[model samples]
Target: MTVEVLRYSAFPEDGAGGNPAGVVLGAASLSEPQMRAIAEAIGYSETAFLSPTSESDPARLRVRYFSPRAEVDFCGHATVASAVAIAERYGAGVLTLETNVGLVPVSTRHDGVELTATLTSPATWTRPAGDSAGEALDALRLAASDLDPAYPVHVAFAGNKHLVVGVRDRWTLDALDYDYGALERLMGREGWTTVHVFWAEDRHRFHARNAFPPGGVREDPATGAAAAAFGGYLRQLELVDVPSRIVVLQGRQMGAPSRLVVDLRPGSDTVEVTGTARRLTLTPYDDVDLP
Candidate 1:
């Protein structure tokens, strides 16, 4: 069967900015291994697979996420990319996705030249800070003083868990290097998606980076799942009031800059992340030979 993979840069205002994701429309026939291989072939951080599940049930649609190395429960960039692809093909509207994590809702629209998607994440949960922070610091060769006292560290989760570590200043956030093997081992043992390193410039603005050794990546330029988790982390810490929204800027240091906007509701426990997507060329997916 023929597969049309659209490339979209999620989270950035300009098409050039943001993380590039592959959207494979109509991926019903592709198997899990096939999807993983296709993602590896595409060489992006993550790619999305979409297939019709229940036309009678509007909320039923099969969605899968594949990193270059493995299949994951949830992926924000792929969701944004898929939503924009769907909006471009099926018109701007609300789309429901049935993912390995749970049901996710995404709304999309076309504003003349660009397409945008806002995804309401699955239920969120936060856990007390773990010892991984100090270990992470050891692996990165950093000190406790580098941490931002304003945002205490924690393991934040929406669909998956992420270690959220906010730094005290830009200098620390800029100086990033770590022992890849050690970090990867620790992340795998802890079931972490990424170690989200951040610096809050202000209430509405922040700079962030994700160490994604668990997924076999040095770092992710744009990380939507972590964004949602961090939003929860702030709320759990009572750092932000309810109904607050924040923008996260990532990948700038790496040169593939991205912008992610996260919205939080005071009484509710879910966070909404919004961003834009544009096309990137890649080999179309095929089950028989893969992409």
Candidate 2:
């Protein structure tokens, strides 16, 4: 059998920059290994597989996420890309996705030719990094002095786990070099999806880079899951004011500059991540043989 895999770029900056993802609209017939194979062949950080749900609502879907190496419980960028694709085909509306973590609600809107999607993450929480902070810093080849004093290290979870680390300056954030093997080992042990390193330009604006060794990618140009987790971290620590709109700029160092918007509302445990996705010209993967 053959499957149609669409390519899209999520969270683009001015319609030019973002992370590319593979979106499979009809994947109910594909087995797990076949889906993994498709994701590996696509070579993107993550791919989204959408299957019809038993629910009668057309907007409800059973969504699964996969990286080149393994399956992920949730993926923000892929979700954004998938939502936009669905909206373009079906029409703009709310999509309820049944994921491994839980139900994720995504709302899609269109501004003329441009389509945007917002995903409401699961309940978020944060915990201190504790002894693992040293190991993470060592893997990144940095000392305690490299971290910003204002933001303490923590493990944050929205739909996935991310290590939130804040650095003092843009220079330090830009100069990111880490031991791939060591970081991968630590992430495997800690069950962390990515290590989110960020530099705050101010309370509302920030710059970030994500080390995503577990996904078989050395780094991610844009990480919506980590952004959602980081937003939870900020809210838990009271780092930012309530009802604030935070902007995260990423991927410039990798030359794929991307932007993500995180909205935090007062008295809400769920974080909202908003971004735009554009279809890529890459040919659909309709020729790949699947068992």
Candidate 3:
């Protein structure tokens, strides 16, 4: 049997920009090893493998995300790309994904030829990074003075854990340099998916760069999970007022600019991350041995 994987770029209106992800539909029979091999072969930061849950629940599907190096609990860009792919084949609407973290509800819409997907993340929370702040700064080769005092460093979680640090300026955010090995080790030990360093452009806008060392990617053009977690982080710290919609601009340094919108509701714990995705022609890979 042959499995098909579709390619798509998420969080950009242009087809060439944004984070590329692989989406595999009808993956119920594919084993964990097979999925990992497929994801590695695809060579994207993350790939999503989907399996239909039950005929009784057309809106629900089982989703798994894998990076080249390992399987992750959740991935935001892949989820958005996958939803657009599904909507293109079927129709634009709602989809419920059963992820390792929890059930996430996603809504899809098509505007002209562009498809946008919004996902409501699970309940979110944050914790102090403790001694990791020094390690994070050391790994990133940044001084404490480079940080934005407005937003303190914290380990935040929506669907996945991220170490969020606010940078003092966009220049510092753009000039991101890090020790990959050191960061990989630190993230592994702290169970962080990415180290998110951002600069607040204003109360409603921000710029971010994510270091995804554990995923084997030096940087992510667009990171949905990190954005969602940051929304929670902002709310918890009272950095932003509730019932607010914020925009995050990313990937300018890498030349693939991406835009992600995060919506937070007052008195509601869930955070919504929305972005557009463009489908790409799939590049074929050698067949993997399936058990």
The per-model lDDT (C-alpha) reads 0.84, 0.94, 0.91
lDDT of 3 by residue, 226-289 (tens): 9999999999888898889999988888988999999999988889999988876655323444
- Tell me the spans in candidate 2 whose CA falls farther than 4 Å from its real position: 282-286
Cα-lDDT of candidate 2: 0.94
Relative to the true structure, candidate 3 reaches a TM of: 0.96
TM-score order of candidates, best first?
2, 3, 1
TM-score of each: 0.94, 0.98, 0.96
Alpha-carbon error at 72 in model 2, in Å?
Answer: 0.4
Estimate candidate 1's alpha-carbon lDDT, on a 0 to 1 scale.
0.84
Give the range of the ten consecutive residues with the poorest summed lDDT in model 1. Answer: 282-291
lDDT of 3: 0.91
lDDT of 1 by residue, 206-247 (tens): 999999986778989899999999888887778877778898
Best model number under lDDT:
2
Pick the winner on lDDT between candidates 1 and 3.
Answer: 3
> Higher TM-score: candidate 1 or 2?
2
Better of 2 and 3 by lDDT: 2
User: For candidate 1, what's the RMSD?
Assistant: 2.2
